[model samples]
Target: MNFTDIDPDKLFSSTDNSNPIMWLVWIVPIVVFMFYGQRIQLQITSGEISKNIAKLVKYKEESKKELLDYLQTNLKATPDAAKKIDGFLEYFTIMPVDFDPNGIIPKIKHLLRSREDYTRQQVKSLSPNMDALEVSKVQNLLEVTTSLHLLHKLVRHLFLTAKKQNNFPLILPLQMMIPFIMEQASALRDAVSALKQGQPIGDGIGPMVVGKMMLGTEKKTITFETVCAEKEFEQRKLYLLKAEGPTATVGRPGDAVELLVLKNKPDIIVMIDAALKLEGEDSGSVAQGFGAAIGGIGTDRFQIEEIATKNNIPIYAVVIKQSVKEAITLMTKQISDKAESVESQVFQIILENTKPNQSALIVGVGNTLGVPQ
Candidate 1:
């Protein structure tokens, strides 16, 4: 059965051999298949890119949400205040760090100098009859604005140095802390703007009222009138000191200040200063106590505190919570709050010491470092 079973004529192969059409049909599909396969691989890579982009968007939105919550919870709002805490956060978050030697620092210095000179000229041109308080307010605004740039440079230096570090220790903590500072700075900017516009200094207290309040604070008030020991209480108001540059020092318990205190013989001396956080302390925590007064260094703060202590005047301190950076950017709120807090404490001290000593001085110390004597 096996030997006779196969018939060659009926079996498998019968062909004329090579055909060009067959080669073309097979090759064309193979080429198309390879091309499609590569295209599909590329599509997979593109899909990965899209996935990463979506993830980045989600991450950014979450970050922004956290920032918003932090600001709203911590900051207070007022109609009179210019820089909302949120504004500062927004400003610093986007600040560019590319340093150029020729770009920033020098330009800021030049602009500040020019602005200062212009302010001096404007003051010189003021009429003798122009309200002195108005003139003084304008001058102070100009000076503060000009001086702020210096503080900004200091901040920039810190930021740049932090960026250059190999290991940025507490980087997240630093980031969290900086936004608070930005808020404070924004508030400062707003305060300066209000001052320039000659808006009322306090809610209901204009500069005139402020001057009067300072003069009327005690039976024997010391001011520009008392600066020269002259009795020009009629023509001269208390708050108007002669025009001095930003660096002019005021709080030094020098003869001028001492004489004022001696004349007043206040029952208590309460000093308020910005206190920085210790290494591991919370940023905005207040510390109240007593310490040495190093004269002549800080803006009249150290000197005045020193003078009060040296005279055996009972000294009390109210230190507001702040970072060193935050302290530099002072809006009126910090100063006002600090001043009121000290004033209240001073009164309390007087009540506590019923039979108190006659002469007392309330010193507002701290980085009076920059304020000239």
Candidate 2:
């Protein structure tokens, strides 16, 4: 074992294979690992994936159970309501073709309206005893259930396909995404209870703040499930818009803004909404920016931007930060307390940007569930 006793001549010896013990102890295993390392990796990762898939299945089942429990306990649904709900799970929509990109917004808008109407009708028919607010919550509950079902089926399909094919590349992506997908599924699972109870979520902060702001002001229903409050704050005319709340819907902020702009002719548009916080960012932080400030498919954002741009109105945004999970789940104390801070910041933005007698349009964008004007 001395350094001087080491043989430099045998260090790179190709003839070392002649030693049976050396070959068995070192070379054989190295050769085996070299040939099968990826296979071993795939097997280990696949095992992990199988465990995650099991968890996903559990979450999916739990969500469906929560839905059925709500139906039976809250709505006194029939015993065979389970069979009726199964049909809602398989509902799918065909997206409008974009071959002609022009006029796509109207097309997409029409489809979205149709989908919402159809879903509402389905929810109403299933829960005839439920009121308007209950109907909205039930519709949202059904959405969460449907999403969990789809998530489980999709992940299971990929898992089986990759396992069957013995394909490492296919499994690699799934392995990497397992953590995120699990987080989303878990969040969705928890959101079921929140939605069913009509609790305010992180996303509701916008509406909550604006709902408070417009407390003494007269409000109008501008569009489908959307509301606008006309108020004068410190010599500035303010047009505040938010989803009509205590109902689980985002409403149509874009249409509301467009209608308000044409009718009232605001000088500046300020939007408030809950934005997704990056990792390590504080959950209840507030940030300022510009533009539509709306989420989802970007159609509504586009509509708002078009109206603002056409009218030469400056668009400003104030955002409350929260994570994806917090947005849908019950409102955290940290996030809920930001309502006051965001309200002050919004007033600051309006005062700093607009002069006295100038009209400012403020739109609070998010689900208004459990928060009312």
Give per-model TM-scores.
Answer: 0.39, 0.94
Off by over 4 Å in 2: 1-21
Clashing pairs in 1: 247-372, 248-372, 249-372, 249-373, 269-361, 271-363, 298-368, 298-369, 299-368, 299-369
> Which candidate's TM-score is highest?
2
**lDDT score of residue 324 within candidate 2:** 85
lDDT of 1 at 167: 29
Supply the TM-score for candidate 1: 0.39
**For model 1, how does the per-residue alpha-carbon lDDT over 141-196 read when each residue is reduced to its tens digit?**
43444334433544445544544552234233444455554544454444453444
Residue-level lDDT of model 2, residues 1-373, one tens digit each, is: 7999977667546687686666676887899889997788889998898898898889878888888898888888876778878988898888889999999988888898899998898777775588889889988988888988888888889988988888888888888888888888888988987898899998999999999999999988899899988888899999889999989999988888889999889999988999999999999999999887889888899999899899999999889999889999999999989889999999999889999999898888999999999
lDDT of 2: 0.88
